[model samples]
Target: MTAEVCEIVITAPDAEWAADFTRTLVETRLAACGHQTPIRSIYRWDGAVHDNAETRIALHTQLIHADEILRLTNQSHPYKVPCFLVQPILSASPDYGTWIIDCTTRPEAI
Candidate 1:
């Protein structure tokens, strides 16, 4: 069975932006919760390899909100190409799955 929830990963240039973005998603009920962590990113950009310190926020919410989350991130993120990865939760405790659904707003309701 397909899971009813998902985890969306987002990376920001700094902690402040990550916090703000996380808050926005939660406040708007797009995400049930966000866990932030500091991470080092090594990537190739513009024909050059770059290493940078970044803040990663993992947002947990209903799978139904993925598209809206993607749209919002693209619209508000500072980076021209922000990191947004949505991965389905293949399995979760029944209680936790229920909590996620309860915490997030249904798209039709907004």
Candidate 2:
């Protein structure tokens, strides 16, 4: 692995779903923290263009555990084709970056 940390971006149908999933991810150490926002999404699906309101989540986690995070998201996310985008954290404050790595190293059941 090139780095020890990564950010996983995902979209949820609503705030409730994003919040619930964020809680689970944090508790299970799949993610150290999550940022959620309400967003307007316009996309083409099944040969039709659609516009909808959605929740976007940015999850911070250790690179080593990214696959497990995807596993959990795939299992619980409501979307038939959930978007799970993984981006390497190229730069961050040393202390902040360390904290993220530390927080996600320890796991707990919720």
Go through the candidates in order and give each one's C-alpha lDDT: 0.90, 0.88
Model 1, residue pairs in steric clash: none
Instruction: Give the TM-scores of the predictions, in the order they appear.
Output: 0.92, 0.92
- Candidate 1 lDDT over residue span 13-98, tens digit each: 99998999889889888999999999999999889999999999999998888999899899989999999998998988888888
Q: Which parts of model 2 are misplaced by more than 4 Å?
A: 107-110
Off by over 4 Å in 1: 107-110
Q: 81, model 1: CA deviation in Å?
A: 0.8
Least well predicted 10-residue stretch by lDDT in candidate 2: 101-110
Q: For residues 3-107, write the lDDT of model 2, one tens digit per residue.
A: 888999999999999999999989877788999989999988889998999999999888888888889888998988888999999888888898898788874
Tell me each candidate's RMSD, in Å, in order: 1.9, 2.8
lDDT of 1: 0.90
Candidate 2 CA-lDDT value? 0.88
